[model samples]
Target: MGTTGGLADDRALLGRTSTAERVADILRTRIAEGYFPPGTRLSEENIGGALGVSRNTLREAFRLLTHERLLVHELNRGVFVRVLTVDDVVDLYRTRRLVECAVVHGLGGPPFALDGLAGAVAEGERHARDGDWKGVSTANIHFHSELVALAGSERTDELMRGVLAELRLAFHVVDDPRALHEPYLARNREILDALRAGERTKSEQLLADYLDDSRTQLVEAYARRVADDGETPH
Candidate 1:
């Protein structure tokens, strides 16, 4: 009886972890697929009941997503999907330009991580061709993340991770991953090419333009989404 009880306890623990992960994936997919629009309230009770999990497990999953910036928790109100504003877009691009451009320019000398960037770009191309827009988005983010990782700063990588998470939320709202990412596929290749050729200045300039274009496109799409939904801008 004691051994059987211990086995049951282990299984229960495993089940809880699995439940949390399942909840996280469901929330992430819904957010990415735009089922729950930005600013949609996430009720723990409702979500847990719908997902067939207890409230404690749902809250644990919510905490993880909140840290990732995919959800925002409000005091007394409850958690909601984060709404990316125009000002947020502007600030996000400003930081991206400052950080990414410098990283590209600073790789003037050899010993750069062009190989990682190449791999990410290649994976993105494959996913793009396979019509896996979500996979393409993941690979695209990996490409830029690799570029920043080349700078060899843990702090920089952490900041970029947060920025990219927020950007992903914005992409979710747009609901057209191909429209948002297809244009940048070749831009990523060009950036990699410049880096390989050791043209730091050229790469930096190209990246700046790419970021500007991306910001403009994403902001316009988000505005249209908001208008269509008749939701006030955050």
Candidate 2:
């Protein structure tokens, strides 16, 4: 089994108390962080040993992520991270527009809590300056996750977490991180600015447009990549 790089260092995160849900959260974050890219075979031995968990516990974690569409189990072959298709990409954006736009549209009056959104925008700008488009991508995801947090509903937060994690699987197939993530930095800022200025409707409109443009960009690029690789979308 091939090693999942950087997973060993994450063992300390579980510390003395480790449960299947906790383990699954760690693995989910690692997936979103690009430590385990799409379709990489997950070695139960290595990951179980790294996290100092029993095989049963590890398998339970794997099962949970599998149900979330983040992993796929193959008969006799073991499990691997999922590689999303163009259809999956389109469906994800549709869900995003529904949830994220609604979140913005449901917000209260001005003087809203814009700290988290502001911070995410800054984080993406910093990554862009450092030429870390991958970091920028992560920050961009953070921005949306924060956007969902505006709803202040734990259930919505949990749902978006899974959706965004699945979305990251599609993001992994992008050949150029800058082209995929760069244009959004300024757009994210624009949305944040409108929100800060008490422009709720404006912010929601910008967000809707942002999600639309991103969906188009990712779907087209993903279709091209899949075609170039001679694989049909499943």
Top candidate by lDDT? 2
Q: Total clashes, candidate 2?
A: 0
Encode model 2's per-residue lDDT on 1-234: one tens digit a residue: 457888887886464335888999999999988899887899999999999988888998999999999999989989989988888999999999999999999999988898999999999999999999999998999999999998899999999988998999988877888999999999999999999899999999999999999999999998888778775332
Per-residue error (Å), model 2, residue 26: 2.1
Q: Give the best candidate by TM-score.
A: 2
The clash numbers for all candidates, in the given order, read 0, 0
Which consecutive 10 residues in model 1 have the weakest lDDT in total? 1-10
Write the residue-wise lDDT of candidate 1 on 27-101 in tens digits: 977886567878889988888888899988898899888887788888988899998877787888899999998
Q: Which stretches of candidate 1 lie over 4 Å from their true place?
A: 1-37, 46-68
lDDT of each: 0.85, 0.91
